[model samples]
Target: MFDVSEVTVIAVDVFGTTVDWRSGVIDGVAAIAGHHETEFDCPALVDAWRERYLPAVGQINRGERAWANLDAVHREALDECLEVFGVAGKFGAEARERMVRAWYALPPWPDAAAGLAELRRDFVVVALSNGGFAQLTHVVKGAGLGFDAILSAENVGAYKPDRRAYVNAAKLLDAEPRTILMVAAHTWDIHGARDAGFRTTFVERPGEKGPDRPADAAETTDCDLSAVSFADLAGQLRGARKGVDAGH
Candidate 1:
């Protein structure tokens, strides 16, 4: 319960926080595999694909590998997963491309679009993610979520969980870190923003990693606030106003 009243801009992590990426990956893989009339363990494939995300991004974040946007990283992961799953030959180049593009149209979480709209009524809500600009633009638009700005770490050459990414995105908004509230489902992300001098809120996404894979649902952390969902976060932000220049 830090002073949410002072916050004017919200930097949101889009992938798992705003969109159900797990389902998207599963559905995307299933669709392609079915088209080939090939039975595959789509969910397992999705889990494997997602598990590679951290390492892929971590490589760039640590400068161990050359910088590549999320799309390129995802393509790399997809190729590896297909090979490991023994289905690499089943998916040709065109099919692989479509599977990767499917990421751009992930369905928003039930609370996402409306909740973000509510928050926007009182504060600037921006999508700040490790995704590339074009990828984020397509994802946000496809999900029908309205963001005041879409800031990508690719533009800054630094990814999230890296302090530089948060700092650089803050500059683009012409905002001081103190005036911005970083909203994310991942504690690592919150830590990054905190290190960059911003207040943070944890928005819970219990199913983000799917049913069997437990989410990062710590009841409390070092974050300024914790919310059950974006709608809950919006309500908390409104309550913090306390009638000063009250929300409409």
Candidate 2:
């Protein structure tokens, strides 16, 4: 356990963690192609679109241009993709708009609803994601996720691994770093929170994200719990609560 002092708020990272990006992107592309009267490989397009994600964000962070929301970045990448596949002529402006709207309609992971519902029963649950406010809002509403508050890197004008983003989230919760638990599937995110003095819980959501994570050489090797799913996480939290309740 990081501190075991009775957690008050659980700040969750959206995207590949709480939600399943692989299926979401594929379905979004299928829906867009249907509305646009165009044909594109749903899997290939989903792969291509996500492949551009990191580079696009890095470009913004490098001062190559001002920051744009994930939707704009995704669209820019999609346009380039259409050009690459020699199919730019197939989509109209309206179709393109609808395609972008698809990002706002992600479906929740099967366990997300149940896990979040359980967590909300005990603590103030909020979104702590790299996505912008609009993007996160749409995702939450679309998936019917009941987050008490939505927070983003946009709020800090920076992204993860940056202390400012974590600091901003902590400020919004009006809770000390140690009093809030940061839950995510990515090691970098978990390490970021640990370095920033927050309790961390790592959830494993395999085969639905970009790449496999290498073992962290710098991790404490004793930070906190690593859960294979949200249900597993809930069990750990329940145990932690029991320990707390028992004055252990």
Candidate 3:
């Protein structure tokens, strides 16, 4: 278990952890298909596109590829997805651009905004994501999630599961790795953070991968905490704070 009293800041993962990217991508792809008068399996396209995300980012993390922002990677994946879905050349340049930009406007999960607001009262809350600064900022503002600050892997030119990404976030916040809590929905992200000596929290987000492939809620010994939602996380933190204060 994590000692919440030692934590000074909470670094949140943006994409699948805090926002509903699956819904946003599906909607965006569906709109593009509709506009072009084409029939496509939007859900399959979204899944395929998202499957490319980690490997593309991993190539850069491993120094096998040059540094490129998530937007560029998304566009490359979009091209491949379009071809696979038999919708290539159906969209004009502007339409394709719009489709890639859909990531910038993802809506937050139902409990996200309110839960973060509650947590922010006691701890500094910031975004520590692989997304570009501009894209993260757009999502925060569009969703009205009121983050204390946004720190992207773009700052370190690497992606999560990379040590530099976690270390950079701690350095930027002027805190020790142990004093920063890394909260994410994906176990791989939690594993990375824990390996970097940061406390980890896994927020359960069913259907994060897809409706057919819902994320498992199995409790892992690797994580310090596991919560069903942001609201539940906030409550647990509040209780932990009280325990610390009373002991003090």
What TM-score should be assigned to candidate 3?
0.96
The lDDT-based order of candidates, best leading, equals 3, 1, 2
What TM-score does structure 1 among the candidates reach? Answer: 0.95
Ranking by TM-score: 3, 1, 2
Cα displacement (angstroms), candidate 3, residue 35, comes to 1.2
Name the lDDT of candidate 3: 0.89
Q: Stretches of candidate 1 above 4 Å error?
A: 243-248
RMSD of 2: 3.2
Task: List per-candidate RMSD values in Å.
Answer: 2.3, 3.2, 1.2
lDDT of 1 by residue, 1-248 (tens): 56677788999999999999989878887888899998878999888988999888989888899989888998999999999989998889899989888888899999999999989998999999988899899999889999999999876998888889988988888889999999999988998899999999999999998888789864755788899988898887777777554543
Point out the worst 10-residue segment of candidate 1 by lDDT.
239-248
Q: Which regions of candidate 2 deviate over 4 angstroms?
A: 35-37, 210-223
Evaluate all candidate structures by whole-model CA lDDT and list the values in order: 0.88, 0.78, 0.89
TM-score of each: 0.95, 0.86, 0.96
Task: Write candidate 3's Cα lDDT for 212-235 as tens digits.
Answer: 986846375378988888788888
| Clash list (residue pairs), candidate 1 | none
lDDT string, candidate 2, 143-202, tens digits: 988889999878877677667778888888889998888888777788878888888887
Evaluation by TM-score, superior candidate among 2 and 3: 3
The list of candidate 3 runs beyond 4 A from truth reads 216-221
